[model samples]
Target chain A: MGEFELIRRFFDRGDRAADGVVKGIGDDCAVLAPTPGWQWLVSTDMLVEGRHFLSTVDPERLGHKALAVNLSDLAACGARPRAFFLALALPRADAKFLEGFARGLFALADAHGIALAGGDTTAGPLNVCITVMGEAPQGQVLLRSGARAGDELWVSGTLGDARLALEVFRGTHSLPGDQFVQVRRAMELPQPRLALGQALRGIASSAIDVSDGLGGDLGHVLKASGVGAEVYFNALPRSAILAGQDLMLQQQCLLAGGDDYELVFTAAPEHHEAVKDAGARTGTRVTRVGRIRTEPGLDVLDSDGAPMAVLLASFDHFKS
Target chain B: MGEFELIRRFFDRGDRAADGVVKGIGDDCAVLAPTPGWQWLVSTDMLVEGRHFLSTVDPERLGHKALAVNLSDLAACGARPRAFFLALALPRADAKFLEGFARGLFALADAHGIALAGGDTTAGPLNVCITVMGEAPQGQVLLRSGARAGDELWVSGTLGDARLALEVFRGTHSLPGDQFVQVRRAMELPQPRLALGQALRGIASSAIDVSDGLGGDLGHVLKASGVGAEVYFNALPRSAILAGQDLMLQQQCLLAGGDDYELVFTAAPEHHEAVKDAGARTGTRVTRVGRIRTEPGLDVLDSDGAPMAVLLASFDHFKS
Candidate 1:
């Protein structure tokens, strides 16, 4: 089996043609007829070897994380995924790796009801770039610039687990074998909060997925919405791995370490009930982590509500 | 400038927000509201260094060809270009190369009125992949399976120019400096037939863009349409580059040498007048190259009406 055969066997089994898709994987292009009254949302992300993932990372998990990250973008926009196109660059033709990768990719795609529409396979260093298209009602799509002063900020799921998982990978932390499996899995196979996002369509004022760490990604929402935020450090959801860490150190990791893939959104206080209803529907906990403020920059407050100063900020691909 | 700065300076110049685009560049995602009565067409292609193009090819042209090839897929479906997302993998950060590439990409994008929505950039071997989105009226998309028996086959623009240019690049052919510039330009920078495709929406029974050599790509259309074709050799458009080549050799080049982004389509005999009108409206010449037959295999005939045997075959990345 080659890459093409592997893709056909593992990833192309779904009947995408019946999903309002005029054309599917077997053509030069895929033709999609939009369901009436819905707008399309498109997002793309590229993951490169040695930069985005470790060379020895599990191929299945790599595939899952790749699609998961892009799905997170859709979640941020309050769009339900429809289909996706993948472009994979491999160093050489490896049937085993591709088979495993496709298996992992399709697992998530099927769960989200997104069909693998079209893609290109070529010879190069391993890079998986996925472009996802989703849909939502017109004028209902959430954006980063919709937040306003006095809005409440919330996050879905836990933060800093993926970052801690990386530390476990580097041997800086000694974790029990089963705990290691769970944490590493979280790092590799993140579940984008798709249901929560769809339910938040008119409820959340603004949103972004936390891929570049909470501090950096939330900073983007703040910058776009032209607002500041006051995050309560004690309210941050952290794994037990960070339970006993120094308060400031744990706060830094929660703020700066990335790969969470959780939805960070803001909503007017009047919609708090709707936010709670969305969380119940998705079976995920939504916590009030902060509030959108009129101030001009991020302010992190401790349990006692005193501002804490910090340095060694979050990851910036261009800054380093 | 770094990658982010370079992108902001060049690719972020156009404001597509006013063009019915809900979101443009520099966002977590782009939201597109589908124009009522139109379905979306999406396709993606990846070009890797040493696999797709030589390292010495002009960066500007490489960028143009990458987007144009994807646009050709949209043309094949008889859709109007709407928006595109690019994923670029580069070895190292080079501002000059990016500027030239963005300039070339935007030049064609502006001509077609397509918006640059969102994409990802990463560090790796040079790989350019573009996912293009287009739209056509509901149920009006021309698929490869729509051709019928006795349909007249047509191709837009000239053939074999890109193949001839590749020959020049390989140093196997020598030409006057002026012709060299023109041929080389054609090989590097292909103009996708977006306007012609939009006009051919209802006229062409079946269509495909000639990217994987005319013979191989046409074979796909035939397989899907469940028909064969009898192509006239002398009817094919030839350039000065093929002036002295043997008739059989030139025919093979036109048949199996790929990288020509022209549209090869079939129309019912009753729609011949309308097809011609489409060509005239788009300012592109359309030639009647062949006729679809009930028989299910390809046949090429010379002007003398004798079958022509050709040796050139389809280009496959894995096979190579």
Candidate 2:
């Protein structure tokens, strides 16, 4: 069987046509109806083997993470994911690998009621590129340029566990077996803050997903919004496992290490209760880490209100 | 500079927001308003380094072709091009390659009036993945399953030259420099039949873009429609460069060799005049090379109306 037939049997959600997808797989294009007065939210992410992931990583988690990262982008926009198209390049079409990948992909897709749309499959170096389409009411879409000076900066869920797991996998650090499992889960299966994002549509002025670390991603929001930020490193959220690590390691992972998919957003201080309520409704922990400033550059602060400096940096694909 | 910064400086269309986009780059997601009451047509195509193209190919053409292929998918669905997101992974961020690639990509985007939405840049083996979004009025979207048993199978533009060009490139055959140029353009820089596809929406019953050769793609229509087709080899359209080739080479390229990117469609025989008008309106040549049959299998007929057999097969990534 060729790539098309294989996809038809395993990956294609043909039944989606009955569930709002005007057209699903097998067509040259998948078609869906947009909610009237809603804006389509688009995000594309490419994950390459050996660079974004390891060969040792199981295919199931790989598939989940591939779609989740793109979904995180939608979450940051306060958009509800409606569908996604996956362009996958496999070194070979091993049946075992395909089964695990599709299961993990459909599992996340089913939970979100997102349809698998259309894409191409090819044989080459292993890579997964997914383009997610979501929607938000017109004028309600969150944007990075919406942040203003004096806004409180808040982040959803814990940070640094994904990066901490990476260090452990790289042999730069070691953790007990149970701790390893916790961190690995954080790295492998990120639950994007979709509910929290939707609830913060009007409450949050600007938002970004923490993919390239809290410090770097927040820098983007500040840069785009023509403002700066002062993030109190001590106020940063970390999982119990990460909190138990060395102080410097915890600081490094929380501030500079990447692959966190939590939402970092800005809200007026007056909306603090609203932010907390949204987090509570979403069942996610929210932390107030800092405030947006009128200054031109970012500043990291310690608990003593003193400037803090660190050598670690957010992941830069080209620079790295 | 980081990947995001490089992308912003070179590829981001910040001004597109003033046109129709609610939000553009530097944001977590791009927000676009789809025309109300239209179905969103989504398609994605991935081009790998070694599997899809050669390292020696020009980067400019590579970029154009990458987007063109995805656009072709939209065309097959009779969708009008709107915007596309590009997720490009590069082995290294070479300045010259990026410039040429961007120039070619933007030129095509400008010609089609399609916006570059949002995508992530990453470091990895060279690969290009593009997701194109288009729109078609609900219920007017043409589908493969719409083909009827008595429909006349039609194809837009000339074919087979692309496959002929591939053989020349592979050093398996040789052609005059002028003939080589004609065929090479067919292979490297195919013009997707977008206008024709849109025009054929109401006239054509079903359509598919010929990426994997006429036989295989036609098979998709047959399978989806639960019908069969009998293609007349002598009636297949070919460019002068391809027509002058040996009989076997002509057969192989015309029947099995891929990457044509032309649209193959089915229209009722009674709508011949309407199909012709669509072709005329779109400035594309339409050829009737086959007829859909109620039989269970595809057939190839020689000039004498006798069964013809050959050893050519459509491009299949894993098998190839």
Clashes of each: 0, 0
lDDT tens digits by residue: candidate 1, B109-218: 88888889888877777788899998889889988888899999999998887777777777877678888888777788888998998899878998899987899889
Over B1-320, each residue of candidate 2 has an lDDT whose tens digit, in order, gives 67867797779867465446666666888888888788988899999977778898888998889899989998999998988898999988888888888888888888887888777788888889999888999888878888888999898899899889889888999999999998898888989888988998788999999999888888888989999989899899999878888999998898897899999999999999999999999899999998999996788899898978865467888787
lDDT for each residue of candidate 1 in A1-320, tens digit (9 for 90 to 100)? 45556457756665566576777776667888888899889999989887789999889888898999999999999898898998888877787887788878989988988888878887776889899999988889999999999999999988877777787777776677877787777788899999999999999999999887898888888999999999998898877766656665576568887888999999999999999999999998899999999988998888899998855266645444
Location of the lowest summed lDDT over 10 successive residues in candidate 1 chain A: A311-320
- What is candidate 2's CAPRI-style docking category based on DockQ? high
- Top lDDT model: 2
lDDT per residue for candidate 2 within A134-200, as digits (tens), equals: 9999999988888898999998988999999999999999999999999999999998888889999
The numbered model that scores best in DockQ is: 2
DockQ values per model: 0.65, 0.83
Give me the overall lDDT of model 1. Answer: 0.84
Cα lDDT for residue A195, candidate 1: 94
TM-score of each: 0.96, 0.97
